[model samples]
Each structure stands twice: as C-alpha cells, then as structure tokens.
Target: MITLSLIGIGSGNPDHVTRQAEAAMNTAEVILIPRKGAAKDDLAELRRAICARVLRAPGPVVREFDLPVRDASGGYRAGVEAWHDAIAEVWAAELADALPEGGHAAFLVWGDPALYDSTLRIAERLRGRMPIEVRVIPGITAIAALTAGHAIPLNAVGGPVAITTGRRLREDGWPAGHDSVVVMLDAGQAFEAVDPEGVFIWWSAYAGMDDEIRIAGPLAEVAGQIAAARAEARARHGWIMDIYLLRRAC
Candidate 1:
C-alpha cells in the first residue's frame, strides 16, 4: 500500500509552512515535485526550498517531474477532463517508478488542497489501480493570506461571505445572498464584469511573498490601477498568483 500525503505548503513564503507540513515532508520516504514549465519555475523552486528547509541532512528522495499542459483547443470542460486524465497517468507512472513496493510518498501542494485545487480529484483517479491511502495536511490558504496581508476580517459581523473563482464571477455574475465575495484565480480582472459602483475591493498579488503588492479602495476608483499593477507585476516576475475580496455597500 502506498500512503500519499498531499501536503499544502501555503503561499510562496517559506515561513507560511506549518509545523505539521514540515513534519510530513521530513517523514516521507519519497517526495514528488512538479515543474510547471519556465514561467512558473519559481513555484517549483518554492516547493524544493520547502523540502530543503524541512528535510533532515539525509532527507527523503526528492523527485521532480514535468507537469502536463492542459489542452485548450476543445470545449473547456472536455479539455479539462482530458488534461486531468493525462496528469493522472503521469502521476501513476512516477509513483510506480519511485515506489515499486508500496511506501510513504508526499506531494507538496500550493495553498490548501480543498480550495480550488485539483490534486485531490486527480488522486482519486489513482484509487482502484493500487492500494493508495491519502492524507491531507491543511495549510494556510491564499484567502487567509490575503486577509492577513491586509489585516482585515474575512466577514462582517453576523454576515456571510461567498468564496468563488474568477471564472464563476465572470460567467455567473455576483452570487445571491452574500454582500462580500472573495475571488481567486482571477487572471483576467473579472471584477470589470460586475457593477463597480458602490463596491469596495481589496486586492493583493503574490500575497504573503516578498514581492507582494496590495491595492484597495472603492472598485470604481482602483479597478484600473489594480489591473495595470497586475499586468506589470506579471511581466516583471513572469507569473502571478492573486486573490481579492469585494463588498457591496448598503
């Protein structure tokens, strides 16, 4: 039986890693890291750094693999399914080669796995093929990092908050019954799709990292600045991970 630990490493900051996550990494017999191409080399590097920092002098064997690229030619849903299938196959091959005999292995995930991440879903594919026992060590999420960076509460007193993705915010518009919305994976500035008036936005890029950038104000006043800043930051760093909170005024 292969015990796979899906450990969340939190945002880019090394210190953001929890003690439990560190312990998991140190105890693993093999650690699998994914290299997501050149533009996101820093992401892969961060995982490696975490391993280097936490593992003992004679640490677990670290294996790096090329991440499969998602195909965008077909319909969005179909393309995602195909891409996930390919990723599962790659993971299976890696696991087989690394641990021909079932043992403990770990994969360092960015942010919390339960939030907008597909690692768990992909791991489900590995079941039935082999005896796989999965463990998830929760790490800080980007939403928590975003709120912490700004030193603000996630929700107003006695009110509810909606957490969603940029794609949904763009496609479905603002969800009902929640005045505050937290948006993640918004590479396209989806806030423009909603009515900017009477709304406030607190945006952060590379949240919890050394080169973090933050912008906040009324949506009408700062949307353009946030968009421009996001573009500049992405150009400068070759990649960006951002999240924001929006609240509609009464």
Candidate 2:
C-alpha cells in the first residue's frame, strides 16, 4: 500500500512549518516536488528549502517533476480537468519510479491542502490505480497570514466571515448574508467590482514571505494603491500569490 501524506508548509515561510509536518517529512520514503517552470521557480525553491530545513537525517529521497500547464486553448474548467489528469499521470509515474516497493510518499503543499487546493482531488484520482492511504498535515493558510500581517481580526464580534475566490467575487457581487469576505486566487483586483462605500480592505501579497507587501485602508481610498503595488510586485518577482480581506460596515 502507498501511504501519501499531503503536508502543508504554510505560505513560503520556514518558521511556519509545524513539528508534526517536519516529522512527516522525515518519515516519508520519498517526497515529490513539482517544478512549475521559470516564472514560478521560487515556489519549487521554497519547497526545496523547507525539505532542507525539516529533513535532518536524509532518509527520504527527494525528487522533482515538471508540472503540466493548463491548456488555455480550451474553456477554463475543461482545461483545468485535463491539466489535473496530466498531473495525476505524472504522480503515478513518479510513484512507480521512486517507490517501486510502495512505501510512504509525501508532497509539500503551500499553505494548507484543504484550502483552495486541488492536491486532494488529484490524489483521489490515484486511489483505484494503487492501494493508497492519504494523510493530511494542516499548515497556516494565506488568510491566516494576511490577517496576522495586518494585525487585525478576521471578523468583528458576532459578525460573519465568508471565504471565496476572486473569480466568484468578480462574477457574483458580494455574497448574501455576509459582511466580511476573504478573497483568494485573485489574478485581477476583484475588489473594484464591489461597491466601495463603507468597505475596508486589508491586502497582502507574498504574505509571510520576506518580500511581503501590505496595504490596508478604506477600500475607496487605497484600491488604486493596492492595484499598483500588486502590478509592481508581479513585475519585479515574475509571480505573485496574494489574498485580501474585505469588510463592509454593518
């Protein structure tokens, strides 16, 4: 049986790794790291760095695989499905090559595996192909890092909190029955779509990393500033991972 551990390393910070995650890393027979090309080389580098710090005795062998890019030629959902299938094939190949005997394997996940991540879904595709058991090690999420970076609570006392994607926020306006929203996987500034009146925003790019940037104020006042900073950061680093929290006055 193949024991696959999906360990969350938390927003690209070494200190964010928990002791339990470190133990899992050290115990695995093989660890698979994905290389998402030059544009996001920092991502793979961060995973490697985490392994270096956590794996002390070097019992587990580390391997790198080229991640398949989504086919933009097709519609977004269809393209993502195809890309995930390709990734599953790669994972199967790596498992066979690395763990011919079928022992424990681990993948280092950024942030947490359960939050806006498809690793679990991809792993489910591998279930019937082999006898596999999945384990998850939770780590700090981008929302946690963003809120902590801004030194603010996620919700007001007795208020509601909503977590959603940038696409959802843009396509659908503010969700019903919620005053605060946390937006993730935002390629564009979705905040501009919402009515800025009486809204406050806390935005952070590269949260918990050394090159972190934060901008927070009344949405009306700093929406442009956040956009400009996001553009500059993406240009300078060649890539960016960011999240933001928005609250409408009750």
Model 1: per-residue Cα lDDT over 1-250, one tens digit each: 8999999989888998899999999889999999989999999888888877888968789999998899888898999888988998999999999999989999998899999999999999999677899999998999999999999988877889999989999999998999999999987899999899899999999998889999999999999999999999999889999999999885
Q: Rate the local accuracy (lDDT) of all candidates.
A: 0.92, 0.93
lDDT of 2 by residue, 1-250 (tens): 8999999999999999999999999999999999999999999999988888889774699999999888899788988899988999999889988888889999999999999999999999898677889999999999899999999999988999999999999999898999999999998799999999999999999999999999999999999999999999999989999999999998
CA deviation > 4 Å runs, candidate 2? none
Clashes of 1: 0
Question: RMSD, each candidate, Å?
Answer: 0.9, 0.8
lDDT assessment of candidate 1: 0.92
